[model samples]
Target: MTLSFKSLGLSEACVAHLDHLDFKTPTPIQAQAIPHLLSGRDVVGRAQTGTGKTAAFALPMLEQIDVGDRSLQALVLTPTRELALQVYQAIQLFNTDRRLQILTVYGGQSVERQVSRLRKGVQMVVGTPGRVLDLLGRGDLKLDKLNWLVLDEADEMLNMGFIKDVETILNQAPAERQTAFFSATMDPVIRELSAKFLRSPVTVTIDQPKAAPNRINQVAYLIPKGWTKARALQPILELEDPESALIFVRTRRAAAELTRQLQAAGHSVDEYHGDLSQSQRERLLLRFRQRQVRWVVATDIAARGLHVEDLTHVINYDLPDSLESYVHRIGRTGRAGKEGIAISLVHPLDKRKLRDIERHIRQKLEWGTIPTRAEIEARYIDKLKSRVQEALTGERMASFLPIVSQLSEEFEPRMIAAAALQMAYDQTRPSWMRVEPEATDDDRRPSRPSGGGSRTPQTKSRRPKINRVSEPSSPSRS
Candidate 1:
C-alpha cells in the first residue's frame, strides 16, 4: 500500500508541511514506526542512513510539540557536527509552517553563541555529545523540560567514545520523557543501549535483505601505494562521466589536495572539509544539487548525511576504516533505485580492512579493470560531445551562432565543436595540480583512527534517563 502521513495520524498542518517538502509517501522506517512513536512510546529504530529515518522521528516529534511552549522540548544528540546540522535542517523543514525555533550546539564553535540562542528560548536543541554535555555541566542549557530525546547514530556515538557522555546527559533528563534511539547497525553495544534505556520501545529495522544497495555496482582497484592515485582517479572519473561525483577521502587535508588536483586537471570540481564554514559547506552542496558543479571531494566528517539524488558515482579516494564507514560511503550513490557505481582505490595496506568489510558483509566485491589512457581519452571525447549537445540545445546557443557560422565557413561543424570543447576543458582544470606518486602512510592517514575505527562492545553500570521540562511560551513569536 502507498502510505500517506494523514493515514499515519499526523495533523493537517504537519501533513501540509510534508507535502510542501515533496514527501508523498512513507519510507519503510516511517511506515512501521510513526504510529507507535506518535503514541509517545520509546523506539529503537535500527535503520541505515539514506532510509529517511530522520523524518520518521522528526515528524512525530514535531506533532507532539506544543507550539505555545518555549522550553527545551526535544533534544537530539548526534555523533558528529555534520549530523547535528542535518537533523537541525530536518527539524527546520518540519517546523517551517509553525515557525518553531530550533538551535544547534556543537564543538569547533563559540559556546557563547549557543548560550545566547538558548537565552532567546528555543524549543529544540540539536547538538553533538561533547557540546551538549558542556552545556549541561555549565548550566547554560537545561534538559528538565525536554519532551523527546533522540540519540541519533547511536552506534557511532559509542564508537566515538561518547557513550558515557550520552548516558550522563540522558541521566539528567526525567525518566518519563519519550525517547528514540536510531542506529544503522544493531551492534551489541547498541542493543544493550536499547535494552537499558527504552521503556518496552517499539523496534523498527528497515535494512533490506541486501547489505549493499542493488543499484550500485561496487568494484575495487588494486593500486600500489607509490602509484599515482590522482592519475588513477582521472581515468575512472572519465569513464564514468558522472554528472556529479563524490570522492571520499580520509582527512580534511587529503580532500582539499585532491579537490585542487582534480580542478587543476580541467574538471569542474570543488572540495569540502571540516575546515570550511557551515555557510560555505551549504553553498557547495546547493551547487552540487543544482548540477552547477561536477565533483565534490570530501571527508566522511564533512559529507555525513549529504543527500544528492543525482549523484552517479562515489569514489573511495581513501579506504574507509571500517565496514560501517564503507557501507555509508557507498550508500551515498545507488540511491532510490538509480544506477550508480562505487570504486575504491585500494592499496596493499587497505587489504585487511577491505577483507574485514567483505567478511562482515558476507560478500566478495567484484574486481574491475582500470581505464587505460586511450580509453580515458575516448570517454573524454564522448563527454565533450554530450556537453556540446547540451549547450547547443539550450536557448543560450543563439548568442554563439555568429561565431559558429564564422568558424564553419572554414572548418566542419564538428571541428568547431571540438575547438569549443577543448577551450572549455582547458579553462576548468585545477591550478596547484601535481601528478606525484600515490600517497604514503605518513601523508594520507591520520595519527589515530579519525573516529573511523570499530570497537568491542562494553557495558555500563546504569541507564541514564532524559528529563522533560515544559515552560510556557510568550504569546508573540520571535
Candidate 2:
C-alpha cells in the first residue's frame, strides 16, 4: 500500500496544501523520518540531494513551531548562502499559516538589515554558520527561547571547514530543544556531530542506487599543442550555442577571468563563485534562470543544491580534482530524461584525470573537434533562416516590402533578397570573425582517440593569454 503525508501524521491543512502543490506520496526518507520527528524524537536522517529531504524535515519542523509565541523558536543552519536561501524559501512554501514569521541571514548582505528583521520578532531563522555566529556574538540574535534546531547538510559543513562555527551555534542553543541532523553520508565526523548533539536520534537512510550516465552525451575537446584553451573555446561556444549552460572552472580567479573573456566576445555570460556578494550572486542566478544570461562560468560551489530548469549543457572549463566530483558536475544537466550535452576542454596534461573519469563511468567519451570558421558561419546562417521565417510571418516585414519591390526593378529579385540576407548576416556576425579569416588547422586535422598524448612538452612561454576587455576585480571569497 502507498503511504501519504496524511498517514505520516500531518494535519489536514498541511496535506491539502501538499496535494494542491501536486505532492501525492511520501518519499522513503520522508515516510520513515516524519513520524519520528513529529513525536519530538531527534532524527539522524541520511539521504541524497534532491530526495525530498527538505520537505521531510521542513514539514515536521514547522508543525512544532509556536506561531503565537513568535520569539525565534526554531533555527535552521546551512553551509552556504545558496542553501540557506533554499531552505528559507522551502519553509515559506511549506507553511500555510500566515501568522508565522521567518528570516534568512548570511554574509555579503548588510548585517544591519538582518538585525532589524530579528528585532521585529521572527519565529523561525535560517542562516549560514559564520553569519549566525556573528549575530549571536553581537547580541542582535538569540536562541534562548529556541524550541528546535536543525543542521542541514551536516557533511558539507565538515567539508567546507565550517564545523567549528556550527558547533559554537549548537552549543549556545537551548539544550532542552529538539534537534535533528541530515547528511548525504554519515562520515566519522558527521557521526560524531550527531553523537555529540542529537539525543538518541533515529537513523533514516534511503538507499539511492547509482544512475547510469547514458542520458547525457559526453564529449571532450583536447587543446592543441600551440593553442590556448581560451582561444579554442570561442569557436566551440559559437558552434555549440548552448541554450543555457554552466561552465565549471577550478578557482574563483579563473571564473572571473573566463567570464571577462567570454563577455568580450559578445556572449551573454557571467561569473558565479564564492567571491561575489550574496545580492550579486542572487541577481546573476536569477538572470541565468530567466534566460537573460545564456551561460555562467562558475567554480565547484554550484555542483550541488543549485538547480535551474531545462538546463541544456554543462561545460568543464577546468577539470575537477576527484572522479566523483566530475560525475556530479556533469549530472547537473540531462535531467528529467531529456538529452543534455556535457563538454570538456581538456588539456594534454589532463589526460590521466580524463582516463580516471572514463574508467569510473565505464564508458568512453567522444573526442570533439575544434569547430572551423566555416562550420560556425553555416550554423549562424541556419539560425538566421529561422529568424527570417519568423520575420516573414510577422506583420513587421511589410514595412520593408516596398524597398524590396524597388530594388527588384533594378536588380534580380533573388539577388536583392540575397543582398538583404548578406547585410543581416554581416551586421549580426561576431567582430572577431568579420575580417574574412582562414579556418584553423584544427578543422583539417583529425582528432586522435581519447588515449593519445603528445610526447613533446609544451612550455608556458608558448601559451597564449586570455583575450580580456578589462582588468578583473577581486571579489571576496564565500
Candidate 3:
C-alpha cells in the first residue's frame, strides 16, 4: 500500500504543498524517518545518495520550524557547494507559501552579500562546513536559538577531511537541539561521530534496492598498451552509441579537454566543472536534461546532486579516487527502476584499482574487448540499415521518391540506392573512423589481461578503409 504525507503526520499546509510539487506518495526513507523526526527525536538515517533522503529530513524540519520567530532555527551542513545549493532549492520548492526566510551560504560568492542576507534574518541556512564556520567566526551567522541540525552526507564529509570542522560546528550549536545524521555508509568513524553528537538517536537504515546490479549492466573495456585512453574511448563510444550519458573525469582540465575532443569529433558533448559559474552549470544541466547535449564530461564534485531520468549510460573516463566515489558515479544511472549501462575504460597501470573496485562492489565486471575497426564498421552499417528501413515506411518517403526516380533514370536502381546509403553513412558516421592512425607494435602487449587474468591475443595489424565520401558540407541532422 502507498503512504501519503498526511498519514505521516505532516501538517495540512505541508501536505498541500507536497501535492502542489506533485509529491503524492512518500519514499521509504521519508515514510520511516518522518514520524521519529516529527516527535522531536534525534535520528540517524542510512541510505544511498539518490534515495530521496533530502526530502525525508527537510520536510519534517521545515514543518517544525517556528516561522514567526525566524533566527536561524535550522542548519543543514553539506559536504559540497553543489549539494548545498540543491538542498536550498529543494527546500524553497517546499516552501510554497514563502512563510520562512531561507538562505544558502557557501564559498565562491560575495561574503558581503551573504552577510547582508543573514542580517535581514533567515529561519534556515544550508551551507558547506568551511563557509559556514567562517560566517560563524566572523559573527555573521548565529545559532543560539537553533532548534534543529542536520548533518547530510556524513561519510562524504569524513572523506573530504571535514570531520574536524563538522565537530567544531556541532559543538557550537545548542546541545539540546534535535540532530539528524545521514550517510550512505555507516563506517566506524561515522558511528563514533553519531554517538558522540546525537542524543539517543533513533537509527533508520533503508537497504539499497535489491535490483541495482540487475538493473545496470556493468562492464569494462581493456585499453591496449601504449594507446591513449582517449583513443580507446572513441571506438567504445561508436560501438555503444549511448542516447544520453555522463562521462566522469578526474579533474577540471581533463573534463574540458575531453569535452573539446569529443565535440571536435562531431559528438554533442559539453564540459561541467567548478570552474563554470552557477548559471553556466544550470544551463548545461538544462541542456543535458532536455537531450540537447548527448553527453557531459564532469568532475565528481561538480556532478553531485545531478539527477536525470532514463540516463542511458555512465562512462568512467577516469576511475574514481575511492570505491565510494565509484558507487556514487554509477548510481547516477540505473535509477527510476530503469535498466542502464555502466562502462569503464581500464588502462594497464590501473589493474589494482580495478580489482579494488570489484572487491568493493563484490561483483566481477564483465571484461569487454575494444571494438575492432571491422566491428565498428559493421555496427555503422547496421544502424544505416535500420534508418533506411524506418525511412521506407515513414511519411516523408513520398517527398524523396521523386529525387530517387530522377536519379534512377540516369543510373541503375541498385547503384543509386548504394550511393544514397553511402551519402547517409558519410554524414552520420564519426570523423575519427575515417582517419584513425594504424596501431604500432608498441600498442600491443603479450601480458595477461588486467583484473580478469585472461591471456592477450596476438593479431596482425590492419588499416581501416577510407570511405569515398568527404566530411559533410553542412551541419547534419540527427
Which candidate tops lDDT? 3
Report the C-alpha displacement of residue 247, candidate 1, in angstroms.
Answer: 1.7
**What overall lDDT goes with each candidate model?**
0.76, 0.81, 0.83
**Model 2, 1-478: lDDT tens per residue?**
8899999999999999999988899888999999999999999998766567789889998888888886999999998888888888888999998999999998888999999999989999999999999999999998999988999988788878999899889899989989989887677988888899889999998765542257888888888776667777877787888999998887788788889878878999998887677778889888988999999988887544566778899998888886656766787787756888998888899988888888777777877767666667778999889999999899998898899888888899899889889999998877766765444433343344445343222222121122324423435432
Clash count for each candidate, listed in order shown: 18, 0, 0
Report the number of the highest-TM-score candidate: 2
Global CA lDDT computed for model 1: 0.76
Q: For candidate 1, report its TM-score.
A: 0.78
- Per residue, candidate 1 scores C-alpha lDDT tens digits across 42-136 of 99998878888888889888887876888889999998877888888877877754557889999877899999999989898999989999998
TM-scores, all models, native as reference:
0.78, 0.85, 0.84
Local distance difference test, candidate 2: 0.81
Q: How far out, in Å, is residue 116 in model 3? A: 3.5
For residue 275, model 2's alpha carbon misses the true position, in angstroms, by: 3.6
Model 1 residue 235 lDDT? Answer: 54
